[model samples]
Target: MRVASEMGGVGGTTVMLAQETGLARLVEALEGTAREIDVTFARAGSQLGEGLGLFEGLKERLTTLSTDLSGPEIARAGTTLSGLAGELRAINDGLLQETGVLQQLAAHSKDASQVLERLLEHMRLITILARSARIEAVSVQAAGRDFGDFTSEIVALTTQAQRTIQNCARDHDHLSALLGSALEAQRDFEGRYGQALSALAAKLEQTLVEVTGRQQRSVALTSDAATHSGKIAMAAGGAIIALQSGDSIRQQLEHAIKALRLLAAVTAGTGEGAALDAEARTAAGIVLRRLEAAQLEESARSLAQDADSIEAALALLAGDTAGLLDLVRSLYQGDGGRSGSFLADLEADLAEASDLLAKCDRARAGVDRVTSAMSTVLDTCQQTVAALAGTVSSIVLIGMNAGLRAARIGTGGRSLVVIAQELKFAADQVAADAAQLTPTFAQMQETSVGLKSGGRLDAAHFAALDQAMSESLAALRQTGDRLAATLDQLTREGGGFASVVAQARLSFSNAGAMSDLIASGAAELERSVAEAAMPDDPAAAAAAAQLIERQVWPNYTMVGERTIHQAIVGALLPAQAGAAAPVVVAAPAQDEADDFLF
Candidate 1:
């Protein structure tokens, strides 16, 4: 009976030790897996957050570049260029009209010069007729002695008429010289002005072409950037969803770890195997609840969504980058070179036009001086004509006096009366010629003023337009370059974000798998503990005790003089029921030196 009781006690203790060892190992596995899950959760959350952050940053940058900077700048540039092109076209049209006007003016000037030539010839003919009349008067004088003073008066009037003719000829020559100089200036201005306008027009057309091309590219690139920005926003949202799943998984792992620790504590006690099994089942229930709550499958679904969203975003960004790259390629291919050439040509045209304008200013100054000199010469001619008029009037009066004297002397005064009448006609003719010169002088002054004012105004307009166009083109180019650089940076960052999201997804998957493994291990350990055999018979307990005493007790006692073996033996060796005396077992000689009171 005693032996059977000892065997039963040893068997129960052995079963309890086995359960404790299994529970400990199971707890170790659960803790290790939980730790791994925690690490994975942290890493996945960090990665997901980083990816989302990068995507958001990229979105913001794209928004600023596409919406705030590049888009508006491109549109403004397009509008400005369109306006400039219209202005250039209008200016070119005006230039064409001005060229036609200049041609007409040149033609009219030639005609006016020809008319002046005829007027000069007529004046010479009139002077010759006056001289012939004077010679006839002198020849007839010899026929009558009383005609001597009349003949002398005729000679004086003829000499004065010759001087008047010479002065008119000099005035005509001066007017002709001024007309020749104006005609040459007009021809030179027309040629140079036309060439400058034509060159400017061609350059403006080229610049417009390049601007239009870049505007199209900007539209496409900005559209692509906007699309990519939307995609990035979606991707970031998806990544956040995936990270939420990782959070759920982490929570489940923590519960599992807690349940496993509870199970280990219960199994390590001296409870019955059935109680241990019950506690393990309870732990398993907790694990199941944790798993159900973990929603690993949901996490996987979220990860899939994240991946799809990221991929879509990547595709959008890739397309955006491709468009930007095409624009960059276009810029690098030949657009920049063409633009530079256009700028260079425009500058050259502007410089030439500016030089022409300077020349025109100089010409205007020269024209002013010429007009002033001509006005002075005209004033001098008028003075000379006035003096000649006074002299002719004096001659006429003298002829009149002679005629009175001759009339007083009877029919002898007839010759004197004819000379006085001739003198009066000659004076009237000279006064009429001087009156004609006033209108010609006024026309010359008006022409010089028109040319100076008109040329200067056109030159100023050309300079202003050219400067505005150059500044606008330069600003557009700068905007394009900055946009290209921004696109390149966004592309690089988008790629990095994609990579981070992918890695995070993989880590989440691994963590989920580890959690499942830990749950499986806990369940298996519980099952093993529940199925483990327990010795119920006292005889079997006695045999197990004997084996433990021979093997386990000796080794266990070596750890200390008084050990847990003594406590267990003392507890297990209580007296049997209806026994008269307590059962005392003899100590072995080898254990005699060891004080064991059981």
Candidate 2:
């Protein structure tokens, strides 16, 4: 009662003016601060949502990229490389065989030519002996005129033999030179081209396997991506919970605004002999100011704590997201714009293999042509050797007949007999030479035949393989290119989460500052309260701090907010200060209750 009397009376008009200009404005300002906090938290939550959006479908894409890298498309390319290698190897071996046979045929040609030349010398000697016999028989004139025909026949035979042998030698020379050229080419092919073709074939296949194998390693990358995807998914879940803190803070701020507005109501008393005098009212105002200060402090702390959590979650999410991008990029192997995709590399290897294999094919085909030409020349040589043998036989017969005729002529025929004997010996020598040449010439013909008839090297799968492999590689290229594009898009769009997280963190950290504004406005209104009331007492200040006006209790839509206020705030309405139990609170509006969940 003494405190009430000390709480000097204030007129309603004066109270209204003070409340209108100061308390009312403070209430309006607190409402503004509360809205700002709502907006700020809303935006922060939205930003967190955006951060989570960057990794959607990322795991599936990574798995697809891994599968494409090791798919059957790539395997087909490898097979093509292997097939080309085999074809080139076969050509190398075939050419070697054909070349060796041709080389042998050339040697045989050289030997036959030598034999034919020796036979020519013998034929010349026989012609000399036959002519000598003819001249001696004519000098004796014992039917020597008849001997002229024999000499003529022998001369004709010698001439024919000389012509035939010379023709054979010429043909042999031509064939030998041709075979020599082929042999030289074969040497070059074996020494240089053979190893090169083999290497190209092997390297084409080996490099293809290696290249594809390297790409297949992307499957290993999926392991890391899968882990990162799990973390991102989990972190996103945590972030969802952290983001919901905004709604809770928004509700708290709304409650704080309602408290300030109710303080305005206390200043404008509802009718009557007066409930709270200026002292009581002034004390209550101070209590509200302090409570708002506590609320502001609490709101700031909540914001900072939630912000820290969200930012941490964002940190992990961003890192894992970036890691997934890295894994996807590895599938392309930095071959994005270099025109060096898996398909490109495979095609290049195939082209090189085709080129080298084609060269080997041409070389083998050339040997085939050389062997064919050698066969023709060898056939001619064999015929010439046979003709020469026949001519030598005829000359031997003519020489024997001359010898017999000379024996019948007695003394005059003795010189003719000696000539005939020498002629027969020379003819025999020619026959011997021709006989030796026949086997050599026949061997050459056989070699030429063998070379022409040998199996040819083949690469019949080139056309089919090229089409099949190219199709497979084309598919792989599309997948790889898509992955490269995804990685590039990620780099441009979501690559830097650090800055985004920082901005969000900074915004949320300013939540404490917004609360400070509300507390500052409250202090300004308290100055008005101090002016209207008597000097502040410590007891009144404690009572005011402990007051929880019933006006604001209805707005405690959240159960946690009400529970926390009753337990930790140690606050109660002035009317209920001496109650036995806690005051009963009204249930929130349906709309408010609908959104009461944090």
Among the numbered candidates, top TM-score falls to 2
Q: RMSD, each candidate, Å? A: 15.5, 6.3
The deviation in Å at residue 507 for candidate 2 is: 8.0
lDDT (10s digit) by residue, model 1, range 342-362: 223334444554454456444
lDDT of 2 at 573: 38
- Model 2 C-alpha lDDT versus the unseen true structure: 0.64
The estimated TM-scores of all candidates read: 0.45, 0.73
Worst 10 residues of 2 by lDDT: 579-588
Scanning candidate 1 in windows of ten residues, the lowest lDDT window is 575-584
Assess candidate 1 and give its TM-score to the true structure: 0.45
User: What lDDT score is found at residue 72 in candidate 2?
Assistant: 66
- Model 2 residue 338 CA deviation (Å) reads 5.4
Any runs in candidate 2 off by more than 4 Å, and if so which? Answer: 1-73, 95-99, 129-134, 140-145, 189-192, 211-232, 260-290, 333-339, 408-411, 435-455, 458-547, 571-581, 586-597
